[model samples]
Target: MPKNSIKQDENINNISNKDLLIRLFSYLKPYKLRVFLILILLIYVMLCGLLNPYLMKIAIDKYISSKNLQGLILLAIAMFILNFLSMIASKTSIQMLSKVTNKILLKIRQQLYEHIQKLSFSFFDNRPVGKILARVIGDVNSLQELFSTSLTSFIPEILTLICVTFIMFYMNFVLALMAIIVIPFLSITLFSIETISRKRWQNYRRKRSNLNAYTHEDFSGIKIIQGFSEEEKTSRSFLVLTKDMMDSFVKAVRLNDSFWPIVTLSSGVGTILVFFYGISLLKSNRITIGTMVAFIAYISMFWRPIINISNFYNTLITNFAAGERIFEILDIKPDITTIKNDIMPKITGTVEFKDLTFSYNNDATILNKLNFKIYPGETVALVGPTGSGKTTIVNLISRFYDPTKGSVLIDNINIKYVNLESLRSQMGIMLQDTFLFSSTIMENIRYGKLDATDEEVIAASKSANAHAFIMNLENSYNTEVNERGSRLSVGQRQLISFARALLANPRILILDEATSNIDTHTEKLVQSGIQKLLTGRTSFVIAHRLSTIRNADRIMVIDKGNIAESGTHKELMKLKGLYYDLFMSQYKFLD
Candidate 1:
């Protein structure tokens, strides 16, 4: 298993249920009027339902037993009208609730997506993309039932329970007491079951997240699995994750399924007790037959609400686990955030690292007490062995990561105090692995400057030597590039990336092995275009090919996180230092 897989299994601390619920329901505040109207409609529906049983009691005592046909027909018609109105109210309330719930869901999903975008890159570094997707798409979806049913079903049931209890006592206190005798025992059982089920639900959600993460990773790397002939092994591993998720779901459902039986048994016991006691009351002439029948009807009505409430509790417990998972991400404080009064000045592109020391997770230093300055419009080439902090230096200048100690400055301004958007917007970076979105060639190039005109986009492409190939495509600049530009060759992708960078017209440009993947012939073709793009911009180039940096104004050989040599290429060749050794190693064949 990969190291990230192990990290995924680590336990997540859940917030208290009370706090989670408070925060979750806050999303409903915006639709208060709609919720209020739904509540009123639901109350009316419950009242209409309650009236039917009383009408039945009246028919039995005043009309059926007495054989009064006129009275019976009148009561039957009334019952029908009441039932019809109840149906209308129920339907209307549900429709309204659905609209409100869906709108709230849209807002929640939007907020989550925007928050994820603002989060620092470090957050993404440790989490799987699939796991994040599960939170935004799956976890948010789990709350749909809660939203739709809470106002229409759950709240109405609570009101029903209260109303039934009061009406039962008013009719006959002794019979009402008998009907509710088993409630305390039922409540205890439910509370105990809920305690056990909450943990099981948490486990189920965690396992589901893991399964999603695994599936996403496997599909993303399907090409590698085929290349290595490890399809069977990968399939077995996925099965293990799937099986774990299934087991957890089954265990949670088993506990949830127990709830209905307990409620049913309790209701049965209450009804039996009420029946025998009511018969005794009637026999002793303490209550009329009509009252006895009404008591029985109330007993049935009473337990129905209890059953609905119990089911709502079950739904709450399950979705509470999902809610906890979602809020955890929302609670994370981004490592990088802009100050309220941050500056957005136009950059002159003079970058300086002042007494900088940095580490990842405070493990080992990658750059130590580094100090360097590049004047505006100077092109500096960096050559270093792998892991010698070549990329780290450029990353610092771009403000991707803050130094553990000291500061990085741009145009005599501390980057930490500058608006992140303003700082990054003025800089263009093209890495060895060029990433192009699944979009048309023109749109992908225009991504650097969203408002760039079509003519400007075409001009930029021509400057990067990409216009000729783009014109040959079936749709010219309109041709679609598949995900990450997989449809284009390596050289074509790099040139498009260059076009994108050139279109940005940034003051600072960093190229990290931008031509590393291109063939020799392709590199020769792009070399002039690259020089033209870097002519008036401050540039940092990390190149392994010594020939590419021969004309660089200055070349710095970085070793062990420090500059081992710095001078023009010809000046460094006479020094016989690290730069000389690296150059000789690459072009020794020519000698």
Candidate 2:
């Protein structure tokens, strides 16, 4: 990865609000009917708002002015009925909007998940899980306010403004024109403030995501930090990030605060203009007293929707920014994808890498023209110094990445032309660090093969030498493993992982330095289990310890991403190459 990509913060402003809105609205395509129905309800609600001032005018001019008590009672009842009907429509619209919004959110989340799953290992290697999660869950959630509140409120508020403006103009054109003049200035001020606030808020969102990433990394690696007595340093680092996040958030809130007061003062000015100007018309007897009173109500009513329109625009911008973040993840096309015509091929577990050149980036190579083959039922050990591309080789075999040049073949079929699931399903891999999900021990073991029976699980566990220790626990297979299996000791976790691989019953097995961190006793137990497990499968073992691979059918010493030496222990020792020197250096320790 380049240094530019290595930085945690990437420029997120590449996609604009309009582009995000277009994408988000596309997701809403499926729920179009529900959205339309919600809009209709909103329109009805706005109609009710327009009718209220008119109804009050009727009560004042017809009932009160004529001194007809019965007319007053009837008008009051009519007003109550309109409000009741509006309330029902409002409630129904909210409920429907909530349901549709949730569905849209679910679709976005599912697409994000599928995209992430399809991404190459290199993408994950470069991006943090916390950052991906922020895009999927946190940023997607920010759109809820947009869909639920903004959608229903915005449409009706806009329609209400138009309707009220029309009604005011019809009642008295000059007064309505004068009252509306403040709109342009108010809009300009609100929009300017909203733009600044939204930018600040976007920064706040980025910082919040970074904070989440730091917190997740800290907690996940807490054991290591505590063991090395670096807790205080980690805590201080976290506090600094937290403080920065809080400061950004405060800046956004302060920006929002400055604008609300201005809008309020502007609305107050518009109201004073309407009242003072209308009373002069009343004194001149140019309009009825009731008309003046109704005009005042309309003035109050009209400005609210205008203010709401400004508020909605502010909300829309913030949500659009969040939507852009979410779409950025959704837009990531995987670098490596299975060939459309790929199909599973019959295999005898004979693996071959033919002139494979690989790189994490286009500029530099990690493995250069690597050529190797493992015969059926053979256990091959790869020994290399750090950064010698040992792990890269295993990654190639699994097709977690495709080679930049040449091919990796299994049973004479290029792995690239094989179904990814089929290729991966036929192999079992246990990395040095085993990860277990939050579930029972049995469930974790069964995760290797979702449909594996209890008897099979026990048999596989026994083969991995994990059954005895598990039975010693209070709940045995029923014992709960917390997130990442943190409750289990390192050896115990390895034992369970081994059992999982065994239950998978793969034709090819990969043990990537499995015993690198376990205690000596546990290593012996795991090594013994591995010996039993490798009986009928082609196995590749990457190890630092010479003893672990000494008895292998073949061992290859890798140097600088190329094979420097290869042979059985005895043959390699006789030849006295890189393997011979490495083995001799540790021969006495094993003894």
Candidate 3:
């Protein structure tokens, strides 16, 4: 049973006909000449198939029963020549078609990869990386069957059936008519089953996509699961999802399996009927034995094309689902895009948010109609309770997400009027959750400025107080951070992120809870380093530890998406407002 399931899974990965044809046509658009050549070879192969049975009938009628050795010799040589040519044609057709199909798959995967990179951030946020990868690689690869087999074979199969039928009718009208009676019945039944199967197949695809997403999320977060000792719980959860996936697959198979057997049985019954009726005609001398023999051969050859045509229905379903998934992604318009003819001007770090209002969804606002400005060379600290829009404000500043209303200006120009890359190039950000690539420490720091030299990387690391700890390591600047910086301590990761930001040399710097992870001593070290970096630059710092931002040129105390207080820390302290109350609350704990 386990072996059987493994085989079933292998078949399920194949693309259905709809997706296959759509993909093949699109990919083959560039290789139309090759595709046409493949089709021509297939037509030649099908013509050979049509001639084979006719050759047998001629030999049997003119030589075998006539006791003529010379005639038999010529017939045998003719048969051998036709067989040899058929073999060559078949081999050439298969090889050419297989190579073309594989090339199409390569093109499809490349296009999918390129298109996905251009998709907006919101699309990735809503979809899983594993599912996207599966669509690009797994789903696209599955379509090989349609191109290599179905597409190349389809025209030949139909042509062979037609040619064989016409020859059989010319020989004996009654026998040919009797044999073809099952065609319409088989076709109608296959069509109905295929329609139902396609819907089930689509559902199966969705479930599989969901399964991939869950498995990816689970494996990526394995460390967190182990840290919380939730392995058993996670396994149980995964088991439920796998079970549903299996059930969906089983249902699709059941529908697909039913059609194949019905087709096989229908062909068997038709052949039996043809044999009985043809023999009666032969015994009555209505048709010659040679004619009866040729008709039987045609009957046997006939059902293969029918079966192939029927099976293409299932293949079409798989392809349709795959095509829909691919098109769905390609159709999405990026939420943020650069405007036509917009050019960013040189900036001097001044920033202003005028009546900014935003909501992640349409429901409730996260940032209300509010206005604030930071002059050149000023440090503005944003302090707020959880869910008070501190990070949202910074996100808008970086153009990660745009405001639903109002304007954000940098150097007196609305951000929307500038080229996205140019506007963002003048700014640097370090989020609370730092992301490090699985590369060297030097590369991580150089990520901020792709052209930074080794010396510059070291300088940036020193400015962020990350150079000492990095140098203490065995590999120092060449140390691999591993995936998501898993090999580094939280404090070390934060330091590296700060170093990356420093390398950018931005006129506008954003520190979103940058010092939240370091120890008290390390925090003090980072604080001193930050003061040096922040000098002569406009900076926005979001700090949970209010003491870190006490010397800010201005402090904005935010509450529920509105700026409730704005002033120097000393002046805000005199008001004894929300900021004072929150700071004093934390101060008592410190005391």
For 1-591, candidate 3 gives per-residue lDDT tens digits of 011111122123435555646645777788788778878877877777777787888889988888888988988888788778878877887888888888888887887888787665566765667677768876787778766656555677777778777877888787777778777887787778878877777777777776777778888989899999999998887787788778888998898888888888888888888888888987889988888888888887888787776676567665666666666566667677766637777678889999999987565899899799889999999999999999889988888877899989888888876788887888889998899999999999999999999999999998888999999998999999899999999999999999999999988999999999888988888888899889999999999999899989999999999999999999999999999999999999999
- By lDDT, rank the candidates, best first: 1, 2, 3
Q: In model 1, what is the error at residue 547, expressed in angstroms?
A: 1.5
Best by TM-score: 1
* Runs in model 1 lying further than 4 Å from the true structure: 1-7, 589-591
TM-score pick, better of 1 and 2: 1
Query: What TM-score against the true fold does each predicted structure earn?
Result: 0.96, 0.94, 0.90
lDDT of each: 0.87, 0.83, 0.82
Question: Could you list the CA RMSD of all candidates, in the order they appear?
Answer: 2.0, 2.2, 5.1
Per-residue lDDT of 145-230 in model 2, one digit per residue for the tens? 88776677677888888888898999999889878877788778877876687788788878877887888788888889989999
User: Candidate 2, 169: how far from true, in Å?
Assistant: 1.2
lDDT per residue for candidate 1 within 1-591, as digits (tens), equals 112452266356677878987998899999999889899999989998778777878888889899999999999998888889888988998899899999988988898899988887677877888888888999999999987767766889889989989989988888889889999999999999989999999999888889888888888788899999999998898899889999999999999999999999999999998888888888899988887877777888899889888988898899998888888788877777655548759888788989999877676899889888998889999998999899989988887788899999888888888888888899998977799999999999999899999999999998888998999999999999988888899889988998898899989999999888777887887888889978888999999988998999899888888888899999999998889889898889656
Ranking by TM-score: 1, 2, 3
Model 2 spans > 4 angstroms off: 1-8, 362-364, 517-528
Q: Provide the clash count, candidate 1.
A: 0
